[model samples]
Target: MKALLLVVLAALPVSAKLVSREQRLDLVRRARLRQAVDPSTMDLLNGPQGDGSFKVGEAVSCKYEEKDPLHPLGGHSPKFPCWTKSGERLKVKYKGEANPEVYGEVAGSRLLWALGFYSERMYSVKIVCENCPADPWTSTKESPRAVRTFEPATVQRRLKGTEVSEVEGEGWKFSELDHVNPAKGGATQAEADALRLLAVFMNHGDNTANQQALTCLEGDPDCKAPVMYVTDIGGVFGGKGYFTSYRHWTKKKSLWKDAGNCVADYKTTDEKSNDPEISEAGRKLLADLLGKLSEKQVRDLFLGARFDDLSKRQPPFIWPDGKSRPLTVDDWVKAFLEKRAQVASARCPR
Candidate 1:
């Protein structure tokens, strides 16, 4: 019976083509089945270690292949480029029996179910292992481990009103607004405000991966606000302290210093020291934005919570001398919402 099943499975089609970004996102969003068994029985041939484990929020390495139900076996292949719902470009990698042929068919049916739980969408490719069996296939027994690889999706340059370049001496430039103030341009003001809020949260969360130039949008020369976007947030909520805590401190120092320096550099009056390329209005706008922030707001932005929460939960990070803190994500979220409401009401005024 096993021999017959192997013969039949071997005859079945096995390979597939690369999926477009739209299709891949759709699969991740809508797919109901989070896990699938390898039909090729490669795990049996290669032993339990060969089976792949899939977990929520864990990054997977996969590759793209032409869609074909009848191809042979292999593993570890390059993937094709795709886009995310947030308009960011990404690539998908496939491992195990996740080849295009298997993935394409399964993805269409399973995607919607997957999205019901995970708010974020995902893209996936397929792979094949040559040394796998073809009958009585079982999910390989092995500890769940996510494959590690640098995702190129987050690379960004130039936002509507921002010019991001690594020019020596001149420093990062945003030429849209006058010197020191970021509010000169209406659109720039909105973008800057959004980034400021985001930066505060990121700083508190200690998200180093996002600290660099990750989420930036290009186009719209008239607007000069730096582009910021949130990519892979898996590391946001929970993780080991060694990796997460270290990153927290490292990112905090780097972002705080760079952001503060950038603000100070643009706000300075000395044209010789300031980048000549930056507009006076832009500098003024940055200064005004920074100026509007109270010391408490700055602290809150960095600490991310009310004093009450901190007393109860006691976050992992040490509070600066004489500083109050918040305890939970809920507490921080509530405070953030309240502050946003106040800012909106004050700025927009009915």
Candidate 2:
């Protein structure tokens, strides 16, 4: 029976549609689904996603494939760009101390989901790559790239429901967001502003046009209106300067540029985030989403992202008294709540 099932699955045609930004935008314009900001689903928080585990067999196995220079994976770390055994494709993000993108991306993406935003379904796992190299990152210029025995390393499966535009950097910019910000059917200005507030709160570093996506949930047959989301948020939490600047993370909590005008201070000042024009509803949304997280959830978020430990390569720091203090999951939880309060409490004076 299992053999027959495998055969049937292998014969099935691909169901996903990789459309252009314009095409996806048109779908949103004519979307049938309610895209309202104040939907019934907004009433609850989704998750802090636990320990980031995946059961056996569910783990995706990928053989090394060419890295699309136009859309490369593993910004600083080693990545296995390959097709999986499940007849689907995804990039496997490997973890390392020198490459803090692994941890930041995991925690950042999870935070997006918890706040009711559509995001990449990244899960932590351990697996061996078939016919791989010791350093999977070597370009084609290197010789004998194929090796049979590769150690089982921690990799996060970047699930796709998220479609890419063939034209590089062809994503929705913050300025051109009126169509999808409050999208056409549902999302409101307040809701849109709240999302902007979110990016600032995290000090999102990769605030580029290409890092966002317009995607329908993976199995949606009737996806007239796909939700637009930030596809890459791995550059969050540690600020734009360093990948895991726990000190920077803890220090930067102020989120408002002008409380009276409802303006937010996006750490990276650009047209995409300047003067967000926040509203009361936006503040409430932040409060509603973040206020619901318990101490356990907050701790789990950072710990699961492997933020509990200190990186020796990131180098240690000393206090005025000459005492070294390691950044803990506890430090992150405190910073998260502090920033949450700053935004949630942001008042637009009448």
Per-model CA lDDT versus the true structure: 0.26, 0.57
Best by lDDT: 2
lDDT of 1 at 176: 21
lDDT of 1: 0.26
Q: In model 1, which regions exceed 4 Å deviation?
A: 1-187, 201-329, 345-350
What would the per-residue lDDT of candidate 1 be over residues 1-350, giving only the tens digit for each residue? 00111111221111112333443222222212112233222111111121132222234333222223355232233333333334433334332132221221122111111111111222222222222222112223232323234321111111122212222111221222123232322233433333333223222232332222211123532223323222222222112121112223233322222332233211112232222222234334333343444444333332321122222433443356857444543443343344333223322111
Off by over 4 Å in 2: 1-77, 82-90, 139-169, 181-183, 218-222, 309-313, 317-322
Please provide, for model 2 over 1-350, each residue's C-alpha lDDT reduced to its tens digit, 9 standing for 90 to 100: 00111111111122234555566566545322122233223211222234433532134466666556775553556666555566544456664555666667767776776666766655444445566666667655354555343222334433334343434335556654556443356466566666777777777756767676544555654564456677677778867656556777656556777777777766552455555666787677767777777767777666656664433334455567988865456666877888877876667752
What is the alpha-carbon lDDT of model 2 when measured against the actual structure?
Answer: 0.57
